[model samples]
Structures are given as C-alpha cells and as structure tokens.
Target: MSVENVMTLEKKKGFTLIELMIVLAIIAILAVVLIPKSQIFKNNSKNAGVTTNVNTVRGYLETKVTNNGGADSYLNAATLKTAIASNFSLDSSTFVPTGSSSSEQLVNPFDKTKASVAVADKSSGATNNTVDTVETSASDGADGEVVIYVCKDGYVVFGVDKGGDLTQTFKVK
Candidate 1:
C-alpha cells in the first residue's frame, strides 16, 4: 500500500471530548428519568401488595367467623396476626404485612406507616362486603396506638363498597 493511503487508512483513535460529554449526558438523563420511575413502580407494587394482603386476611376472617357460626365474631390485631401466622403459608416471623416492624403493627403499603390495615364483613352481608376499617397503629390517634378491629356490622378500615371484589384502588381521604 502507498504511504499516503496507509496514513489515510489509519484508524480513528479516542473519542472527541464533545462525544464523550454527549454520552455522559445521555446516561445522566436516563438515570434521572429511570430512578424515579423505578421508585414509583416499587411503590405501586407495595400498594398492590396491600390490597392483596387485605383481601387474603379478609377471607381468612370470614372462615374463622363463619366456623364459629355467624359473622358476629371478630378478631383483634394481635390475635389476627397470630391466626394469619398459623394459617397462611408464610413463616410466622415474617407473616405480618411487610415494610414495617413485624411485632404487631401492620405496615401500610400506601402510607408506609407502621399502622396495618384489616378487612372483614361487618354487615354479615351474608355473601357480601363486610365493612372493614383499615386500622392503623399509634401515631394516628388522639390516644396514640390503637389496634385493628373487625366487627359484624360497622366500619373496619375504610368503607369498602359492597362490590364483589375491590379493584385495588385508593385515594387518601
């Protein structure tokens, strides 16, 4: 090959400072967008987990209340957790809803507070939605620190619609 042709054919070496800066800028931009989005998705999963946990607990409550004959029965926070530990497939130590201390306080997926929520039929709707209150731990009450309650005919957490199933949606009142 001719010397001039050889020189012309020499491979380009190293990136221009501008090119490197552009690539770095792109990565930075992607990080900015993706970081928040990832967090949002994580929170969404946690929220959906809240709904699923509430529903599962409600079903167990139904069985417990019914086996005792009638929906007049109820379960308090500690007892309810114990029941869940025994009945559900999770290890007892980790059975409580996640994202908080497992002692007794149920974690709120939406609020990220130690206050846990519960569900049950208050109307004994007899094949309908039982009014359940999403009970929270202390830090949300005048007295400070309360337990979750599920009764035969009253509010449990929030006023759940008597609809057959909850769509896993919520807006803080």
Candidate 2:
C-alpha cells in the first residue's frame, strides 16, 4: 500500500484513549449504583430467613401444645423450647439460632449452643415481668430446665441464656 493510504488507515482503525476512558467511567458508575443495592437485598434475605425460621418453630410449638389440649399449652419460652426439642427433634446445634446469649437460640434461629432455655410464667404465683417457672413438652422438672416468663399481655417470652435476655415472645394459639 502507499504511505498516504497506510497512514489514513491507521488513524481510522484505532480507538482514542478518551473513548476507552469513557467506557471505563460508565462501568464505574454502574458498579457504584448497583453494588450497594445488591448487598442490601442480600442482607434483607438473610434477615427474612431468620424471622421465618423463628416463626416456624413458634408455630410448631403451638401445634404440639394444642394437640395435648390447651391445659398442656407451652404458655412460655421454656415449654416451647422443650416442645421443639421433643416433638421436632430439635437439637442444640440447630437450635442455637443466633448469638452467645441463651435467648439467642430462640430469637436468632441460627445459634447452635446448649445454653439454658427459659420461659415467662403465666401462673398466678409468678411476680410481674419476672420468670418464676419452668415448662416443657417433657415431664416437669426434667433436667432440660427452661426459665419461664409470662408476659403482662398474655404472651410467653422464652430465652436461651442465664440472664433471660433475647427472649422470643409468643401468643397462645
């Protein structure tokens, strides 16, 4: 080819640095806008999974309590936890549900420890807002002790730790 023709072809065939930079900038903008939104969706899915699991356990506990007659209802956290372990074969590993706190197992639905379980009392002998009793799907006083706290509004609060923090509350079905 002639020198003039070769030079013209070279000028037309290649992309300028500015055009490449513009493409890169567009990609950067898309990443900035999309990355965080995707992460937000992921976090939301995780949280929903946790809530769904907790509610599922709660529903199962209610069913067990109902089958035994309302007189044998869980009515508290400890009873519900025992019901889950006994009726559903819920082990300490899968029951942990959340953090190190005893209540984490009940509330987090992702903890996997053997921390003590407790429930709120609904009996007349209990002090207000204090957990004073233990209930279970197993026979009463079974070594599987769970503290019980009967809520003022009739919901039972169950926790996993000694302090009774992180309780999951439930209404009688």
Candidate 3:
C-alpha cells in the first residue's frame, strides 16, 4: 500500500472533535427537553393515584350508607373511620393491617407510604373541586391522609400528597 493511502485511512479511523462535540450537544439538548417532561409525567401518575384512592373511599362510603338502610342512617367521621379500618383490615394510624405485610396496605403513591382515612367536619359545608379546604377540615387533619366530608345527602372524599390533592363527590341515589 502507498504511505499516503495508509496515513489517510488511519486518520479517518478516529472521529473528529467537531463530530464528538455535536453528539454531546445533541444528548444535552435531549436531556434538557425530556427531563422536565419526565417529572411532569411522574407527578401526573401520582395525582391519578390520589384520585383513584379518593374514588375508592367514596365507593366504600356509598356502599356503607346503602347497607345501613339509606341516607337517614349516616355515619359520623369516627364511626366511618373505624368501619373502614376494620373492613380493609387496616390500622387507623398506619393503614397496615394487623398480621399483614406492608404490601397489603393502601399506599400513598407520592410518598410511597401507608395511607390513612379521616373525616372532615360536618359543618364545613360542601366545596366542589377544592381539596385544600377539605384537608384542613379533616377530623384527624394530617397530610397524606384521605379525608371524607360526609353530608346529609352524600359524601366527598379527597387525598393530599406532594403531587397535590384530588377529590371526588358522590351523591346518594
């Protein structure tokens, strides 16, 4: 082979500095664009989890009201909490059931911890789409706990976490 040809082939075997810089720049740009979006997606998923738990509590309340023979027989916050804990086989404080593993407890998605259920004040009056007020009105009033606002005609259930709060209102039918 010619010396010139050998030198040209050896030089071409390595990447240019500009090519390496361009690749790094592309990777940096992709990270800049996608990192925030990934966080948003994670938060959205946690919010959805809070929403699901609120709905589940609402459903349980509805069933309880129905089984107790209708709207006239409403459960107070303490009674409702106890009923829920017993029904779910969970402790009121930790939400983990006695003699059960952590996996069996209802977990708050945002914090990755056990979820508790509490009741809001009866006189707080019903507020729609706002969970902050409801949370403050809870009888047990703690962050990362599900709060239920019981009314004469229905129930409003909600939960708060780092991801934010989600609420669901269920009407008696």
lDDT of 2 by residue, 54-126 (tens): 4655565556557766533434545555555544344543333343334323343223343233343455454
List model 3 lDDT by residue over 1-173, tens digit each.
Answer: 99999998888877889999999999999999999999888877776776676677777767877888864466755666677777766776656445545543555565544555666545345454232233333334344567666554455666765434334444442
Q: How many clashing pairs per prediction, in order?
A: 13, 22, 0
Where is model 1 more than 4 Å wrong at Cα?
73-82, 85-148, 152-173
Off by over 4 Å in 3: 1-3, 94-104, 123-144, 161-166
RMSD of 3: 5.0
Highest lDDT among the candidates is held by which one?
3
The better candidate by lDDT, 2 or 3, is 3
TM-score ranking from best to worst? Answer: 3, 1, 2
The runs of at least 3 residues in candidate 2 whose Cα sits more than 4 Å from the true structure, single-residue gaps closed, are 1-7, 71-79, 86-90, 97-170
Total clashes for model 1:
13
**Candidate number that wins on lDDT, 1 or 3:** 3
Candidate achieving the largest TM-score: 3
